[model samples]
Target: MRLHRGGRLRWPTIGLAAVVGIGVLWHGRAAPALPTAEVKTGELVDFVELRGEVKAVKSVTLNAPSSTDGDLQIISILKNGTGVKTGENVVQLDTVKLQRTREQQQSDLKRAEAEIEGAQAQARLQEEQNRTELMQARYDVERARLDVQKQEILSAIEAGKTKLRLATAEQRAREAEQKLRSGRAAAAADIESKKQKRAKALFEVQRAQRGIESMTLKAPVDGMVTILPNWRGRFFGANAPEFKEGDRVWPGAPLVELPDLSAVRVAARVDEAERGQLSLGQTAVVRVDAVPDKEFTGTVSDISALAKIDFSTWPPPKNFDLALRVAQSDPRLRPGMSATARVAIDRVPGALLIPVAASFQKGGRTVSYVLRGARFEERTIEIARRNREQIAVARGLRAGEKVALRDPTEEASRR
Candidate 1:
């Protein structure tokens, strides 16, 4: 059926050659290569990796002094990272208002004292006047009695007059005695009331003085001062400012943090999936993101029982706060530094493990592809456990067995 070339009848031969070339082209296409891994027996470490921040194991938070009067205004604060000594002044609130209050209280106290003095003087003057009147009354009574005795020698009318005069004198003397007693009682009561007022004024003055002292916060322990975030009724975000002069801080608001540099730790949040994998006293390898070159060893010390949710977002993610005590302290490890912790939960001294990619789920069973004579054969394997990088095989696979990392059937389909 081919066209003839040159001489003779060559059509049949040309047709045969064309058929052979097509056969060769069909047989020469390359087969796709399948990537594989060899199962190995080695130490398998099951660890939970967490991203966290460096923190002080021991930290003292300095909160703004509790004030009955509104938010306290910061007047002076030690700069962040400043090393401080014990009892050193670290923060100071605006004492202008407190000082004014103290002054007023003192003035009130002075007034109270003056009132007390006036009350005492008035009492003394009353006592003297009462005494003089009482004496005059007694003298009059005695004169009246002497006149009455002389009346016995006079006429009956004179006697009667003298008797009336004596009776009036005696009545006047009794009235004077009553007035003196009443005056003393009134004076004592007045003086006591003034004393009570003075005591109250003194209390107010003392309270004001204590408030002034509270305005100046002193460092309880010696350490570097780190200013805390000023919430200021705003959402926490990157670039939040710290407490500074002129900032109004609410009562009990954290103004500064003095971190004990000698003791350090890492605080990390664990995902719900890894919650059961972490336990107290678990060893971990910690690496600071800022100081990557330096690695620290730590032990899990604490874990929150309740999950923390950020309500600001819808469908918030649950995070559990956990702390790991650093085995050794480093000068470069500072609070707020981002870090990563690889907590070793379970360890197998020797186990047959393979890359997770080497296994696939088939018929609800773990299966691997084993190469046999240039063909991949699907082999069912029992998986004991799986980690991030590898899976531990319990049965159906042996150490040193070569298996396809990816399904070879996919390669065949592509080819």
Candidate 2:
């Protein structure tokens, strides 16, 4: 039986309602996972751990010959991920056009040589003709002078005629000499022009031969061949095809890569604020996504001298690009794999460390929930060192004690 609406319920009824209310509250909220970790007695490392992507140290790309005369079409290519040896051909371009050009250039070169020879022969003949004409004119002038001398013994009319003949012969000799000089200069110019044409043809022939030789792309090292995307094609977005047979590629287009698997690296960028914390030769431990179980050791090989702006956020924060050269290469490590790296900067011996999430800021004090018996005991902690994922406690904590990874007070309030 139920009590009247305005009347108070008896103890049994009140007790049942309280029980139901508590059950409903417990059922409505599922318990949060209490991730716990023990404070460990070990050397505390002041480390900077960051997420990065794994990349090869020498991710070298094989590009089409930059000296090519024009665009080259691939005639043969190795399939993607094909294992290759040093000096092995990875891609072969169509040599038909280059070969034809070489042949044409050779022909032009031969023609120019022949033309030069003919020009020289004509020049020699012209020189001989000019010399003969000048010599004949001089001889006629001499003969006319002799006649004028003989006319000295004749009458005035005969002497006048002889003088006129000598003057006319002298004028003809002068004209012949001028013509010989002009003809020599013209012949020299013609020969020079033919020689220049021959030089140009020779250069073209050499260039064509080189272009033909460069059509076959070779791997520089012994590694697996990875076909690269066609630089000429933006036609396919993420599904863009690799440089394959029958693909038209321009000069200097990257076609393949013989990545050095034995030596790899993790390329990462950090915000500008962390730039000063990093330097060359620092030891870094990299854990790649593909090789989930293995840890790779590396050193800071390079650090960018300048900061690059990241426009992804407001205020355009700057980031520094750095490379971590893996000391030893593993076969499983590949470029473009996600990786996480921890770089140890400094260390403290015999220090107690705990999960960073265990600490909470309560009443301006850093406190953590220590699991004592069946309940959590809140104790203020003194942090001697701290990092991204861990914190070293100087006081208020001890080795071998389990701590709650999350705020226990917040969970109690929710309950």
Ten-residue segment with the worst summed lDDT in candidate 2? 231-240
lDDT of 1: 0.87
Q: Which residue ranges in model 1 land beyond 4 Å of their true spot? A: 1-41, 233-240, 311-314, 352-385, 390-415
Steric collisions counted per model: 0, 0
> Considering only N, C-alpha and C atoms within 3 Å, which residue pairs clash in candidate 1?
none
Once superposed on the true structure, which residue ranges of model 2 sit more than 4 Å away at CA?
1-35, 51-61, 68-76, 94-104, 113-196, 227-254, 310-317, 362-364, 407-415
Per-residue lDDT of 134 in model 1: 91
Model 1 earns a TM-score of 0.76
User: TM-score for all predictions?
Assistant: 0.76, 0.67
What's the CA error at residue 374 for candidate 2, in Å? 3.0
TM-score of 2: 0.67
* Total colliding residue pairs, candidate 2: 0
